[model samples]
Target: MPKADAESPQAPVDPRLLRYASASRGFFVAIAAIALAQTVVIVAFAWLLTRAITSAIDGMPVAELAPTLGWLAAVVAVRAALLWAREAVAARAAARVQTQLRSALVAAVGALGPEWLAARGSASLAITAGRGLDALEAYFGRYLPQLVQTVVATPLILVVMWWQDWISGLTVLLTLPLIPVFMVLIGLATRSVQQRQWQTLQHLASRFADTVQGLSTLKVFGRQHRAAASVERVTDQYRRETMRVLRVSFLSGFTLEFLASISVAIVAVSIGFRLIDGALTLAVGLFVLLLAPEAYLPLRQVGVQFHAAAEGVAATEDVFAVLDAARASKGSAAGSADSHSPVPEPHPAVPELVEGRLVVRDLRVHRGGGMLPPLSFSARPGTVTLLEGPSGAGKSSVFAALRGAAAFDGTAELGGADVRALAPSQWLAWAGQQPGLLAGTIAGNVTLGDPAPDTAAVSRALDLACAQALDPALELGVQGAGLSGGQAQRVAVARAIYRHLRGLAPVVALDEPSSALDAQTEARLWRGIRSLADEGATVLLISHRTSARAIADTVVHLEPSEVPA
Candidate 1:
């Protein structure tokens, strides 16, 4: 029942939406055509009903009025059919737009990479892509169609009424402004409250997702109940906001309906007086009276549907914000987040996957509003560069910078070309501290991103990763849950090794690759890593174990950010 406001900033039909979701362009045209037909059907039904009534009043036989009555029935059926068609079209268009927006959103996130997502929490983005986009059903299926009807039907109906009887039309014209006036006034208030509701819902979703993801840690700390209570408080706040929105919606609906009814009543009374005074004929008076309600109906319905689509409208704003950011960041390579300097794309002069020699010059990683310790090293093909550092000595941060997971200052070059100019997948195969894996067969996980995977290479990579005993065909649950900590870590390293074996990546970087392994297994892993380097693949190994220094051609030690290098 909330008043629909075209003037409200949040109520704008963002032009970006049309540009992004091309499916909606044709939908508007289809809805306009249906609305025009419905407008015609409405006039025909009203005129025919007037004819039938006048004929009966004039003492015409039932046989003569049959044609008028039959035509009126046909008009009603056609109008109903058009309504059904609009609904079907709206539903289809909503689905297509939702899909298009969601796909674009995901692609944009990927283009931005983890750096941006790290700042903009993935949980909220998930909500925006999932349920937030889903809310477009009401926006497209109900609110948008009603808006089209208001635009196409209202003016046309008013024109017909004015043409039939100028007095009634003038009265309607004077009173019609009241609805939108009130709508705008009410919308100004509703806009902020509705936005609050949407934001609170997102906050609630994020909190709940965070709680679920860290439930075990919370229980261990004996703070699980506190976390649950915090979630409940957010839930209650959301509920209160929702009820407040409902109250405003109900009040707005009643106000618009009251104004529309009053306007119609005024027109009706005027028509009645004219009929009594012999100033208007039975047909004209009846036609004008019948058209009065039709003039206001479309606009009233638009306001009612606006409230229904409020959530969707808010969601679209969030979606558009992300799309806009992505568009603004277009052409900025993933690795260029730290600098505004121009980034050159991979040029033909530089051979793909050439040499895989890594040269780091005065590299400093940016983390948590501060810079990490400076690091510099050169790792060449056929050699292992053992990077030894304490826990917070920026070892993992260096890998993050090389992989475009964080912003950094200074230069990292692979094969004499700036690493920022090239994608990580082009030259670097990496396994980090976390065994990031998806639900899939072991073979599938190992061969990810390789269109044509070699089963022989998969076995070789697993053997090198010390995961040869793990069945290639074994299936994994979410986040590779079927495997133990050590097993999953080995599988992740195997995946990286598989990429290197396939010749897709020339450098294999391991971040504490054997962190979960026993001493015996760790030694085997070190041997495998050393062997890979001997085979002419550049390798960078970050390990806390001093024993790793034995395999190194170059051992680079790092200090903390606060300490002297």
Candidate 2:
């Protein structure tokens, strides 16, 4: 978790955040209006208090100053009320914008889909969306409102101070520039510190995720100790970086306060001299003295809160970068060969397709800056089709293209109609080589993303995929920890099988489904695959195993395309 240090120096707030704040314009307007009102009350309170004090010094009766004192009390009350309202409005605005920004980011990520997001690790993206956006709370609640006060109240108080005593006002004016100058000097250091801290935080999160995901593999290879050492090193680095940020924040805050206090002391001293010489009235001198500190207060707060909002600003930058990349990819894909291919007719809202004939004719897929050779295959309903290729043979690329994740040239059709025309979710039941187990119940992973999951169908699918060892109601830890690799793979198979059994999709596809299974479990899994094919569904499976080829009704072998030397 990122700590919010109120006194830390921060970088300038992004204008993009300001534009995002436009959504809560009314709340900010209320905040500004309330701040302006508070400024007026501050002036009145200072003037009244000075007058009451001055009257007493002039030997006026306490009773005679009662009404002036009463008005002073009333002004104090109004200022307090304005303060509360200003805080409330700022908090509300922060909550509103945080919600808006986070939702927009999540929606954009979903629109980009798994392929793009996978390229950028899920752990980093999760941190950006979760803790990153959460950091904005300080930006909105404290820093932003204080920013408004610095712009509105400080200047107004300064103007009142000027009207009361020009010399004191001139002194404040000359010294006022020092606060921001010192703030800027500190902010340069703060910005670099914050950037490093944020980067370290992201690195730590990514490393932890990677270590956890590969812990099994590490254990198998007798490298778990090495992985733990790496994790500890990363954790230590993060701790050091965090401490550095805190140190800088405290130092910057002390400097801002020292400068502000010095400026106030100078004003107080000058006013005292003027009063001893009888060059200034007691009321005016006292009023200027009181307002002097108030003039610098807002700027001081801004400098401090800037550091608190630093992490949020960095996180926002990362999220927008992801969204921008997604948009650029979509724009690029829109002009690619996939977009030019004939689009299939829109399927009905409810997926009612029970069976589909699969066809891939002269299909060339683009992936990772390379193109797969043109490939063709066909499978009738109630048949299992296998795609065979060695490593780097583009079998996975073909799967990605058929799944509509990769852009392609040529045609992929279902039942003589272009597969692109069919609703992707409605026509395809996909289980990738990676299990893709989420953090939830076994049943939940099995029925994931299904609009309406049926209990009987879920149970039957689980049984068919031979994942009965996992209790449907039992909660699984992150990434399905505690489950063996075969169990996880079977869980994914159950998910795909459930979708088809529920008639949500007609074409069931599995990528290397038997990779983790032993011969016995692999045989059972193949039976499930054959059963699905027998039930009038077109089945597509990718494999390099001879055993997989034995069960296939149709085999399509893709040779690695030659790259010229």
Candidate 3:
């Protein structure tokens, strides 16, 4: 069996950041524009402060101060508006990227097929597709753009400070590198902690979903207490992992804060000495002091947001791993091959009727463990072949094999074409022992999202399957819960009959179709099966009951151990 790839317990690498870098290029440009606008506003604010102070010192006049303050207020408002626009644009871009990622993930999973999916727990997929994606919101919406602005804006701010005084500028230049260096070291540490946290979360989600799905089984077997204990153990582990994540998060924040604080202090001390020594004017000294914090601001903010976004980046890596796994071939077979020698004309024997002939030659099915014995049989048009065996005899597996589900070793031809080559919609409708019925009325369940079947056709199918007890208007609760087992089985038979009449497929396989039905209802079901055969459709019936073979034209017995137990 191909197991789901053993994903590294370490955080998977996320390409979304690179994707964000490319997809959000326009956003990056907008961020750069906003940063430039902000720099202009900062410079204007600083110059205005200086002019106001100098004029006040000279007692130049009170009236002149009003216009200066007014201009400064206008500059502040414009800066605020531009900041809002920048954030809005970045958020929209993030949403678009997230949408694209989700669609890609869904498509990749779809292509991997159900057999591949069966190897993994649903909880892991749910977490990756659902909660994991939620984590990326902050990473894309805020952290990414801020990261760009920090890299772009910080340097421009430093240049302006350098123009003011090379000493202060050089002090900033030297100290600035420390913030990111310390951040990188701390981020690396935090990454491991976040990855562990996400793993614990996936384990917990898987346990919870499995427990809920099996709740009825657990109750019937009186194993609820045991299951509850398992759940508690999982929840305890999750709690501990969560605390570990929080501890790392706080530590990362403190690391960034400490590094940034020290750098700012270094700049402040250098400027203060210059002011005392009269190497810097008081006005220029004040300006340098004001600008020092601004230069370090983006770095400090990056630290805070990075911690917030860490969980998302960690989750994204796992999602991408799933995408990578999906790129592998889902099944062993490539494509269908022609089973008939010199294939018959496209329009064959029965043009108006949706009847089909089935031919099985040296058919061998191999599940993960071993090869099931090769068996061969054929069902002519207008005949029913009964497949009989005890449970776990590979009876249903035979149906699945005919449906082109796993690696099978031989050939199944339908209407002269290989069954493997037949498109799923071509000529097979294998209804399992438990028919899947959506939540809807009897008509809805029968039609199964197809346009509503005509009333006359539906009435005939229902009457034939002996499901007249169910009202077409009555609501079938979720998964046909409102119906009795016998009623549900009859409804499934009705669906099969309806599909055959509508020409959906020429061959219909039923697995234990009468398992839940009463003797009278079972008789009615056999009548319906015979009626289908009479209409020239090929019918393959699987059942353990000896009486089921009474309605068959032939019987193929499979050993008990050949089926999945």
Per-model TM-score on C-alpha atoms:
0.90, 0.90, 0.83
Which candidate order results from sorting by TM-score in descending order? 1, 2, 3
The global Cα lDDT (0 to 1) of model 3 is 0.74
- The 10 consecutive residues of candidate 3 with the worst lDDT sum are 329-338
In terms of lDDT, the poorest run of 10 residues in model 1 is 1-10
lDDT leader:
1
Residue-level lDDT of model 1, residues 174-205, one tens digit each, is 99999988887777666767878888888998
RMSD of each: 3.9, 4.0, 4.9
lDDT of 2: 0.81
**By TM-score, how accurate is candidate 3?**
0.83
Candidate 1 Cα misplacement greater than 4 A, ranges? 1-8, 331-342, 346-350, 561-565
Instruction: Give Cα-based local distance difference scores for all models.
Output: 0.86, 0.81, 0.74
Q: What RMSD value applies to candidate 2?
A: 4.0
lDDT of 2 by residue, 1-565 (tens): 2333434553455555555446567766787888788788888888898898889889999899999989988998888888888777777777787788777778777667555664666777788888988897787777778888888998888777888788998999999999998888888888787877887788888999888878888999999999899989988988998899899999999999999999999999998998899999888888899899899999999999988987887787776666566677566656664566364434555334465467788888776676667888888778899988777787877778766677778998876667655546767899998798889899999999877879999898988898876799888887887688889999999999999888777888889888988899888878878987898878889976778876799998866553211
| TM-score of model number 2 | 0.90
Clashes per candidate (backbone, < 3 Å): 0, 3, 5
* Backbone clashes, candidate 2: 3
